[model samples]
Structure formats: structure tokens, C-alpha cells
Target: MNPIDDMDADPIDVASHWCLQLADGRLQGDALARFQTWLDEDPRHRAAFDTVARTWQAFDASPAAPSLMAMREEALSHYARRQSRRWRRPAGMRRPMLAAVAACLLLAVAGWGWIQAQPDVYRTGLGERQLVRLDDGSQLSLDADTQVEVRYNHDRRQLVLRQGRARFQVMRDPLRPFSVSAGDRTVVATGTEFSVELLAAQVHVVLYEGSVDVLPRDAATSPPPSASPPSPSTVHRAREMRLVPGQELVAGIDAADARIREVDAPRTRGWESGQLSFNDEPLGQAIERMNRYAGSHVLATGDVPSASLRISGTFTAGDNEAFVEGITGVFPVTVREEGPRYVFVQRPGTSTPEEKMTTQ
Candidate 1:
């Protein structure tokens, strides 16, 4: 019986094998075309790819995940060595028994290589900013105080956001697309520029130029009909959304709902200009931004939070303590330093802090 046709072989195993083969950069012409066809032939191909992608993301967080592609290549090379070594083991008086040993050798080769060549290369520490030039000549601007890992090879160019936000200006390559993984979806692009921010419970993508194709991680994991009901076609899964400049798409924490809208993105990106901008930003959000950017603690826990507020201002980068005091001047607040952070209180006579306010 052909090894490829063995009924006991797991579909996941086959998919992983194919993913390795595709990522190995050896397939060409008909062989490559056939692999592509196979990937599109069944849903399992996609599921395997997703697993590979998630594994890639998990590896980004792990010290050993970054070098996975290299390890896979090494493992394949060793498997070939194992195959070559198999025939050299005497005349093989026990043919059937020897085949099992040969298979074991190959498995051992792959497994040991995988274990030993684990990835653990890249990482960013808190309050760190990283700038990376992608394989396609695009630029990645990592936001302050975040971490991420990258794997760019012949087959796939991927970035896993471990924390914080990043702005990507992707160079175009349809044959080899660029993708960024954050939360439950992956943002795929073709020569487009976009910024993706991963907060505690949300993933936000704001396009500055070009367009991005947002695809959910589970897009291909819909369960196969357990009983083959009358409706035999695949479920109408969510399609990718093309976000243009000034457009933003947000996916909730649980991925229950994804939202897209248009806004003044340039103004939203005021932080890049050494100043954080808010256009009627809520009191809570403004505080969160301050906390994220300030090396010193900046909390909005005073009377400033309970009442409505609206603010539009450009602040200097350093001396956040002074900046908080300046905010009091604009909005009628009394500011004081408690420890290293600033807290705001309503100007005793003014109305209570509004529930909502905008900062621009």
C-alpha cells in the first residue's frame, strides 16, 4: 500500500507535511501547482494552514517559535539522510521489519530536529520601539512598549504581535503575500500600508494607505456536517474586508463582532508626532493613552472622570506631569501630583466631570 494512501494517516499530519513541502521552496512547476490545487481541494488544507499560522503566533511568544521554519527545513533534510542511511543497513534480511525501523528512523529524525532546533530569537521589552524592514521592502514601526516576532521565508511573510501596536507599510507581492497576526484574525495585504493595534480585548486596524484583507483565523474551521444535512454547501463564512485609507476595523475580544468605520486617522495618529491627540475622546480613553505613553503614572481617577468632557489639544512629549497640569488649564480642573502620577479634580465650582469627552 502506498504510504500517501494509508487510511490510518491523520489529515492533520498530511496537512502539516504539505505545509512543510510548500514552505521548503523546492516545489516548482507541476508539483507546486498540484500542491496549490490540493490546498484548495479540501477544507482540511485550510485548517492545517490555520494551525500552522497559530502555531507560528504561539511560537512568536515562545523563545523557540521564530526558528521553526529553519528547523522544519533541517528536519526534512535529515529525513532524506535517514532514507539514504536506511539502504546502507546491511541486506535487510527482514524486509517488513526493516521498513518499520526505517519509518522510525525518519520519525526520529524529524522529531529530534524539531525539538533541538526550536526558535527563541526575537523579542521586544516594555517601552521598547522596534523598526523592521520586511522582506518585501516594507517598513514596520513598532509602537512604544511592545513585543513581536517575525518569520519571513520564501513561502510566507508573517509577523505575530505579542503586544502593543505596529504600523506596517507593506510592499506588494501577490505571489507571496504579507500577513500580520493579532488576536483571532490575520491581516493580509498586497502593497498596502496599515496600522494594527492589539489592546487587552480588541484588535484595531487603521489603514493609512492602500487596502488590507482581514480574514478571521477560524474562517476555514467551520465544522463539516456531522450528518450531511440537505444543505451540503459550505457555510457562508465571513469574507475579507478591504480597508482603505481613513478606515478602521475593530474586532471584539471574543471575536463575536467585527466593526468597520471611517475616521480622521491622521488625527488619531497624533501620538506618532510626539503628541497624543484626542478628538472628544472619552475621559477614560484619554487616561488610558496617557498611562500607556507616560513613563510616569498618569491616572484620571479624580472628579474629572465622572463628568462629561471634550478636549482637543496637542501636547509636548516629555514632562507628562506638566502636561496634566496644562490640561487642567484648558478644562477648568485642579491638578495635583500624588506620588509620581497626576490626578485631576473638578474646579470645585464647575459642573461634575462629564461621563464622556473628546480630545483632538
Candidate 2:
């Protein structure tokens, strides 16, 4: 095998390969140490590793984890299952590792029962977001600390945004309307582009491409405690708010206001382009957005007056350390690395207004 294939691969791909190698117990001593050192050298490395780590952890936590791992040791078992050509087809990605894992998931689970089963979950942890392209060519971008369950069937495509935020680009399929359930209501769409941010206290929706229906799932909806809980309450709109392209809707089950606004959808949904921009956005909002692209913990403590005391700029989240530094520069804050656990944000006084005015 080519030892340096990694050098030419995308950095994230290389990181994912390193993680897979580590998980397979292939690296040891110096090589492993070097990988570890490289991972620690930059915030982006940590973010990439963490992405795979969390996915692996989630897979491990599932009921089928053990069986999947067991297949790794079996001799030509996955191959034999594939050669059971009488069955017509088997599960597995074409890639070797993926093929093995996929075949194991199928065989160990007693064959072809859970096809594309929303992974039992699809999630993004704190300071991370992931974009997954569905089999139907629709795009789904998950926001930080998000968990959702997807059940796409012949009749309809359904998603339960259990927590966090997500942007969806639906493929044109009039037969199977796409629906998202959050808070008390469900956002139903047809060949449309939209996003949903399911929060503990509220929910927000933005429309980009096509039209979507916003209605309640349950009558007396309860706010989500967090994003990962199974089957949270629904959110119903007291009034119908039609949002065309470039429109945004904010729904709060607990609060009195659930309104849709005319805003720049591109600016709000800019993570897809690998660029995150803040325009007089609150410290909390900026931190929330930053956390999506980087594995860092940022908070504003000690008398955060209001959202107007905001920061504005554009930065690539793939470069987390610089992103955080660029952000903290506007504030009277210091950024420090904390032993792979967190990135601390300490404010000396208050962020300066003049500093906030600097354009990126």
C-alpha cells in the first residue's frame, strides 16, 4: 500500500483515515504519537478527529456496535455474505472498511430490515456541524449540538429535529413531500430549501429555495430541554406565516412571539460555503455559530448587556484557532487552549465598539 497516499488526500480524509487506523489498532508507538501530536498541533485537526470520534462513539453506542466490531475479525465472512449472490444484494459501501462494516451491520442485524434508518440518529455535537447528502440528492447541513432522526419512506420524507439546527436542500419529488417536526409544529416542504434550528426554548426556520408549511405537531407544545432527547414536544403556529425565498421564521412555544421576517437567508445560512459571518450579531449568537465549525467552548460571562454589543466579520470555521483569535480580538477577551478539553474565553473588561467595526 502507498504510505504517502495520505499526503495527497484531503486533510479531513487523512484525519478520518488516521482515526480508522487508530480504531483498527494499526498504529503504534512513534507513528501513533506523531498522529497524536499532529492532531494537537492545530484546532482544525482536533475538530476533524472529533468529528470521526463522535461518529464512531455514536455508532458504538448503538445496539449493533458489538456485532459490527465482531465482523472485523471474521475471516472472509463479509465476502461470503456478498457471494451469497442468491440474495441479490447486501449492505456495505464499496470501500473495503465501509464494505466490511456495512455487511456486518446487515448480517449481524439479520438482513435487510433497517434500510437508511436515520442511523437510529443523525447528530452533530458541540462546536461541530456536518453536512450529509441524502440518497435522493437533497443536502442536509447540521448545526452544532444537533440530533435528528430521519424516516424517509415511499410516501413522505420525515425528519425529527430533536435538537440544534439544520439546513435542508430538498430534491424535487412531488410524490414524497419533505416534513420536519420540531417544537409544536412541523415544517412541510415540496421541492424547497429551508433550515430548522430546534432550541431548548424556541425554534427558528428559514426558507431559501422553495415553499414550506409551518404548523404544529401537538396542540400544547413543550420546549425542548436539549437537542438530543427522543420525541420532544411539537410547536404549532397560531397564525400562518408564509415565507418566500430569503425569509426567516422564529417560533417560540413558550414565548408570545413566533414571527417570520424578511432577512438575508444567505448571510444566516452561510456555513454551507465554509464562511461564517457576524453582523452586529450578539456575542452568544456569534459563539453559537463559531462552535458549529470548530471544537471550542466560548462563552460571554459577566454582564452581557445586549445583542447590540455585537461583533461583525467573516471567517472560515475550518481554521478554528485563528477564528477564535479573530473573534476574541474584538472583545476584551483572551483565548487559551485547555488540554484537549476546551478553549477558554476570559474577558478583561468589555469588548470595544471600535474593534467590532473592523471588516473581515
- Tell how far residue 44 is off in model 1, in angstroms: 28
**Each prediction's TM-score against the native?**
0.56, 0.52
Please give the range of 10 consecutive residues that has the lowest summed lDDT in model 2: 223-232
Maximum-lDDT candidate: 2
Model 1, runs deviating above 4 Å: 1-128, 220-240, 300-311, 330-336, 344-352, 355-360
Tens digits of per-residue lDDT, candidate 2, 144-191, equal: 778878887677877888877889889988788777888876787769
Give me the runs in candidate 2 sitting further than 4 Å from their true place.
1-120, 124-137, 143-145, 199-202, 219-237, 296-308, 318-320, 332-358
Reference-based TM-score, model 2: 0.52
lDDT of 1: 0.59
Tens digit of lDDT per residue, candidate 1, span 306-334? 32665556554444675576566567677
Question: Model 2, residue 112: displacement in angstroms?
Answer: 10
lDDT accuracy of residue 225 in candidate 2: 21
